[model samples]
Target: MNATGRQTDLIEDYVAALTAALHGPARVKARMIEEIRDGLADTAAAHTGEGMPYHRAAHQAVQEFGTVEELVPSCQQELTIAQARHTARAVALTAPFLIACWYLAQAADHGHAWLLPRTAQLLAVHLTGVATVAALLAAATLAATGALARRMPTPHRLPLVVAWAGTTASAAMAVTTLAFATVSALTTNWPLLAFAGTLAAASHAAVAASARACRRCSRLPTT
Candidate 1:
């Protein structure tokens, strides 16, 4: 093969190995790979400019880029942050729909009366309160990881916080929803019950997936 062909093969092999070694959100991982590839290309070009052959420059670039083990710590940190952000976003986005499901079920139960049995009413109120708090926590977590990231002093343990908190909140919401659904089943219409159930299931799935990502990110070695 020509020097250019050999250089391309070497770079591609290195990138493929790196890619196989890391795991995270697909978009975040793809971006990281592209960024690394670009940096490698730039470094190789610099080496070539200094009189090195193309293939030799590619080898030098890969050497400088470090092995998968070496790159993983910093890359995993970014992935962890991405996973945390994803979980927070999932929780924030689903909060309103979940809240609305409860109200909708209540409305279907009482028509225009907008009332529930005393016990149901109390449970609903408490659930709403908890859900609201969880949503707020998620929003705050998102802000801390994003908009307020630079201004705010973020804790080093933020990813772990996100993993545990997000899992708890999401699981709580799911459990509460199932419990409320069971309690209101007799009073709530089948249509609304099905709708609320579907929404709850979807929210749970999204949040669970995000939480799993956060958990995986947490297990990675820290830089």
Candidate 2:
């Protein structure tokens, strides 16, 4: 049964204290609280079925749930890895955009006019292959890091840092390449070049935001 009567107050107080001791995303915190309440309520229901009164069942349930102190460390660690996994997934999704944007910028600048008929087709093909490799490496790195975050008992600290570093580096490369394209466009008055640069700028912005989130997750204690 759901929390009812005195059980509600007791569960609320316990969850509040548990939340105060834990640090993570709000969603995870709320989920943990919900799960605890559900378990406690079930326990209380079982006690009441044994002929215990409502108030006594609630207290008994709380007692049986054990001390929150011992649960806090594990909860915090779980939240940390989950957060890292989230960032890794984000990196996987966006890193390809960084690759594509950088490739586009380079091709447009090298070939002129944002890959028009007059653009150098041979050079464009070569840049495409290079960008594909970078994108693949980035994807693999993030995927591995994401898996590590999900299951490893300890933080894959070095690998996680490397993955994020690679992500940021890829974005930085895109920005630098796009800057050149932007300059080339301004000099030649190529409107499509500006669009390529704009996309690269957007990818760079996303990487910057992800970097901040990564830094926060890195601070979590994994031991």
Candidate 3:
């Protein structure tokens, strides 16, 4: 092979190793890997400018770029931040839809005069409040991860905090929604039960998904 081919092979091998060592959301990881590749290419080109052979320059660049072990921690930190952002955004967007579903269900129930019981009313209120809190926490997390991140210290802990807050809020909302659905099914007519139960199930599923994502983020190793 020509010197250029050998140089490309060496660089590709190093990048493959780096890719294997890291994990995260695909788009974020891919962008990071591309940036790394660009840096390596620039360094290699600089070495070649000083009269080194192409392959030798590539090898030197790879060596100077550091091992996967040394780089993985920083890369993982970025990936974790992306994941936290995704989880927070999911919660923020989904919460409002779920709240609207519950509202519609409540409205329908009220029209039937079936919402007379205080306990049912309380459960509906509790679920709505919990979902609202979760959405607000999610919004705060987005801000923390965005503009506030530049000003904040120990940014690694932010993801953990995001995970914990999201999980708790999602879990509370899911459980409360389940209870509300159970109450609706027992106390209302078949049509009302079907409507409420369907909405509740969708809401439960959405909250559970957010909770799972947050749980995974929480488990990520801190830098």
Best by TM-score: 1
Clashes of each: 0, 0, 0
Structural RMSD, model 1: 3.0
Candidate 2 residue lDDT tens string, 75-181: 76666655555555555565565556545556545644543433434434543454455456556555655565467534357435633664554455464555546
lDDT of 2 at 202: 65
Please give the CA lDDT of all the candidate structures: 0.78, 0.60, 0.73
Residue 27 shift from truth in candidate 2, angstroms: 4.6
Give me the runs in candidate 3 sitting further than 4 Å from their true place: 1-6, 115-119, 169-214
Ranked candidates, highest lDDT first:
1, 3, 2
Model 3, global lDDT: 0.73
TM-scores for every candidate against the unseen true structure: 0.84, 0.65, 0.77
Top-scoring candidate (lDDT)? 1
Clash pairs, candidate 3, are none
What is the C-alpha lDDT profile of model 1 across 1-223, one tens digit per residue? 7778889999998889888877788999999999999999999999999999989999999999898789888888788888888888887888676678777776677644433467656656876775687688788888888879889766678777777766876775686568556754655365776677678777878888788888888888867
